[model samples]
Target: MTRLRLAGLLLTAAPLALALPAAGQAQPAPNRTLRVAPHADLRTLDPVFGSIVITRMHGLMIYETLFAWDSKLQPHPQMVESVSTSEDGLAWRFRLRDGLRFHDGQTVTTRDVIASLKRWMARDTVGLKLAEYTAGLEAEDERSFTLKLRKPTGMVPFALGSAVGQIPVIMRESDAATDPMKPVTETIGSGPFRFNRAEWRSGARVVYDRNADYVPRAEPADGLAGGRVVKLDRVEWTIMPDPATAAAALQTGEIDIWEQPGQDLIPVLSRSRDVRVERYSSLPNQGMLRPNHLYPPFNDPRARLALAYATDQADFLAAGFGDEQWWKRCGSYFVCGSPNGTEAGAAPYAKPDLETARRLLAESGYKGEKLVLNSSYDIAPIGRMAEVAAESLKKIGMNVEVQFADWGTVTTRQQNRNPVDQGGWNLFVTTASGATMQSPITNIGTNMACERAWAGWPCDAEAERLRNAVVEAVDEPARKAATEALHRRLAEVQPYRVLGQYDQPYARRVNISGVLEAPVMVFWNIEKK
Candidate 1:
C-alpha cells in the first residue's frame, strides 16, 4: 500500500505572534509566503536519493541541469548552450554558457559538472538511466565537455530528458565526494533559487533566496532562452498536511497559497472571495498502485492480476473524487501529450470481471483469506476506492482487510525503511513523480525492475531485457516493438495497477500570482495579481 508520510500533517494555526493587519479591500504585497497542503512532504531534499522527477523538480530551486523541457515538452538547452554530436553518434560536445555562477559565488565550470555527473551515476539508479546510454564524459574547456557513448546512440539527450535527465547540476567534484548528501544541506547550483536553511522537524519549511548572479541567456538565433525569472524575493514552504486547517489559515491570511483541498472543501473554499483555485493537468497514470511483491500471495502474478479485478476503475472515476474534473485519463507513462504516449483507452488491467477474478482467487490459493491493504495517502478517496473494491472482491471470494498507514511512511528517500515493506498491507497507492518524461531506460528501471525497491518480487530479467531493447534500439520500428511488448507483459504481470491520472490543485489568495504546471510550484513567478 502507498504511504503518504506527511499527508495528514496539520496546518497548526498559531496566533500570529507576528501579524500584519489586513487593510480594507486591497493591500500592497510585501514578499509573500504561501502555505501549501501537499498530501505528503517530499521524502528528501537529496535529489540523488529519490526518484529523478522529484529530484529534478527540487533541483529547479537549488541546481541546474544541462537541458530543460520546453512548454511544448521538447528538449532544449539549459546549462549547455549548443551541443553537437559526432557523425558516428558515439561522441558529443557541449558548449556551456560562459559566466554561469553558483549561489556560493563559485563560477560554473566543466570540472564541477564532471564531478556532479559522476556522483549521480554512483548512487542514483534513475540517473544511471542516462549512464546506460553514454560510456563516459570528459571536460574539454572552461565551458566545453564531451560525452562518449558505446555506439551511435542518438537518443542520448532525449534519454537525459527523463526525470533528472532534463537537469544535471555540475558540482565541484571535491565537494560532492565529501558529503553523502550533497546539495541538500550544503548545496551550490546556478539556478534561480538558492537554498538557505532546511530542518525536518519543523516540517521541512525550507527557506530559499534568489540566485542573482545566474546569467544564462538564450540568443534569438539559438531559439530558447531567458526562462521565466523568479519575481519573489523570499520563498518559504511551511509544512501543512491537513486540508481544512490549511484552507482555514489561507482564509485568514496566514499564508499566501495552498494546494489539493479535499473535494468536500472545494466548494466551501471556492466560495471565499479572497482565494483562487488553480487546477493543472497531472501525469497520465492515475496514482500508482503497488501490489506487494514481498507478500507470499502477491508474489504470484495470478494473485496480482486478480487483485486488479477488485477495483472498478470506471466507478473510481465517478466516485474517486468530489470534483470529477480532478480525475482524468492518461495514455502512457510520460504525460499524455508527449512523444511516447498513445491514444487513451480503458485500462485492460482494470476491467472488473468477478467471474474471472474468482477463478484467479481460487488458483492463487485464496478460498476467502484475509488480505491486508496498506495505504498512507488521504483516506477519503483511497478509502472510497477500497470500499468499492472490497465489495467487488467479495463476489469473487476474498476476505480483504482495509487498514491505514501514515502517508509519510513510504520511503521519502530522505531516510530508509519503506512502509510497503513494513506495514504488511498488500496494496499501496500513491503518485509517482518524474519518470513520465521518457528515457525508456529511466521510465522502467526502478519503477518495476529494481529488485531492492520491489522486495517481494526480485528484479525481473525479462522486464529489464525488454526495457533495454527499447532504450538502445535506435531504429524506430524496433523501439516501438520493444515498448509495445513490455506493456503487454506489464498488463499480464500486474506489477502496477493504474487508476488513471488526475489534476494538480493549487489554491492561492486572489492577489497571489505565478501558478505553472511544473511539478514544483515556482516562486520567482509569484507577485500580487
Candidate 2:
C-alpha cells in the first residue's frame, strides 16, 4: 500500500519556504535545528491518532515506511529493502535491509510491519488499505514477509506509498498493539524525532526535542546538538491562532516558520526580503458544501438542485477571498487540472436564477420555508452563502434561511431531521474528505470517492461500487471509466457546491528547502539550506 494522502485535514502546521537565502549574511545559519511555528495544537502524539503536524514534521523523523518519495517525488526504499509482487497480483513480498534500529534501541523486523497492519485493520476509520488486496500478512523471516490478498488488488503498492497507503507505515510491534487514540502510551515510532511533550500552553504549543541517535541519510554539518547526533537539540511549535501573531513571529525570527498566514498580509510579505510568499489559486485546498441526502429537503433531488442552483459560488468566493481566483475552478471532484479530472464541475451552477430556483423549490414542496445551514467557521463575506442561497430561492418564491453552528452541532444536525432555523444546516463545508483511489486520490477526488467506500449524505451506491472496482481492476481504462461514472453522478446530484481548490502558502526563512507541492506534506526531501 502507499502512504496516506491527506486533503485539507487542518492537521499539520508551520509555513513553507522554497526560495534560497541571502548571500552575504554575517549572522550564521544553524546547521541542524529548524524552528517552526504553527497556529494549531498538537492534539495527540500518536502516529495512529493522525495529526497533520505528525504527518509533516514527525512522520519522516520517527516513522519509516516500506517506500518513500525522493527529492523528485519518485519512489525509493526507506524501511523495506526491495519490493516485488506475485504474478496473480494477490501476494506481495518485501526484502528488508539488515540491522535497522528503532529510536528505543530495538531492532526492526517483519513482525513489526505485520503488527502495524493488523492494528490499522482493526481500528482505522477506513478499512485497511492492503486488506482486500491481501487475505492476510505475516513475517516469513527477519527480513522477509508475504502479504496474501483476498482478491487481485493491483493498486496495493500505490496504496502503500500514500498517506492512506495499503502498505501501512510500519510501527513498533509493541506500540502497534496499543490503542493510543484513547490517549495511551503510544507515542513511540522509529522516526528522526520522538514525542517529547504536547503542551497546549496558550492555545496549544506542541514541542519536540531531537533524538540523539537520529542520523539522517545526509551527514550533519555540526555537532551542535551535542552527544545526540541531532543538529538542533529541540524544536518548539507554538500555536499562534492569530494570523497577525504568526506573521510577526516569522518577521522577527521568533518563529522560524509560520503556517497558514493570513492572505491579507500577502502584500506585506511580498515586499519584504526576509520572507517569501508563494500562493497559487489552484491548490488541493477546496471548499465544498455537502448536503445530507438521507435527510429532509435534501432527500428530494429537486430540493438539492434548488440549493445547488441558489448557491452563487462566484459571490461566495468574491466575498470571502477578496481578489483570489475562485480558489480554483475544478472540472471534476479533485483540484482543477489534476490527474483523473474529467472537466465535470468547471461551470458554476446557473446564477441563483430565482425563477429556476423557485420552480425547483415548489416542485420539492418547500414553499416560503426557511432553510438553515450549519458550519464550523464563518462561511460568507457578504451575507452567509447559505443565507444568500436561501434568499435567492426566496426571490424564486421559496422562503429559506441559513444558520451557523459548531462542527459537532452541524454534523449532528445533518444526521437527523433537524429544524430549518436552529441546527438545521441544509448546506455545510467538509473539513476533511478521504479519497478512495488506490494510489493517490487527494488531488483527484477530495470530496467524493475515487474508489469504494461511502461518505457524506445520501450516499451513492453506484459511486461506491465504481470506486471499489477502480481499486480492484488491473486495467487502467477500466479504472478511469469508473472515475467518469462517479463524476457524472456527482454532477447530477451536485452534492455540495465545490469551490475550486486553491494553493495555500507556508512562510519560511529563505533558506528552507523541500516544502512539498502536494496536499500531503512529506519531509523526505526536506533539508536545511
Tens-place lDDT per residue, model 1, 1-529, is: 1211111111111111111112111112335444444545554565654543434555667776676543333344566666765656677777776667777777778888777776666555445555666788898888899888886544444334333332445565566565544344456666777777544343446566756565534321111122535556656666566667777988998878775566677777789999878763234334555666655567777877786766665666555565666666543544454444532232655457777777887788755657666544443566566565556566777776666555444443213224434535565455543334333454432245544333233256676676666666655566667766765655666666655566556678888865655434455455754
lDDT per residue (tens digit) for residues 293-406 in model 2: 645666777877776666666665544455664254454564445445565443556455656766886787765555555553421221344444444556666544455653
User: In candidate 1, what residue range of length 10 has the lowest lDDT sum?
Assistant: 10-19
Most lDDT-accurate candidate: 1
Question: Cα deviation in Å at residue 250, candidate 2?
Answer: 1.8
Candidate 2 Cα misplacement greater than 4 A, ranges = 1-33, 44-61, 69-75, 99-101, 121-130, 164-167, 178-185, 198-202, 215-232, 279-283, 299-303, 345-427, 430-458, 473-477, 511-518, 522-529
- Per-model clash counts, in order, read 26, 56
Relative to the true structure, how large is the alpha-carbon lDDT of every model?
0.56, 0.51
- TM-score for all models, in order of appearance: 0.78, 0.73
lDDT of 2 at 73: 27
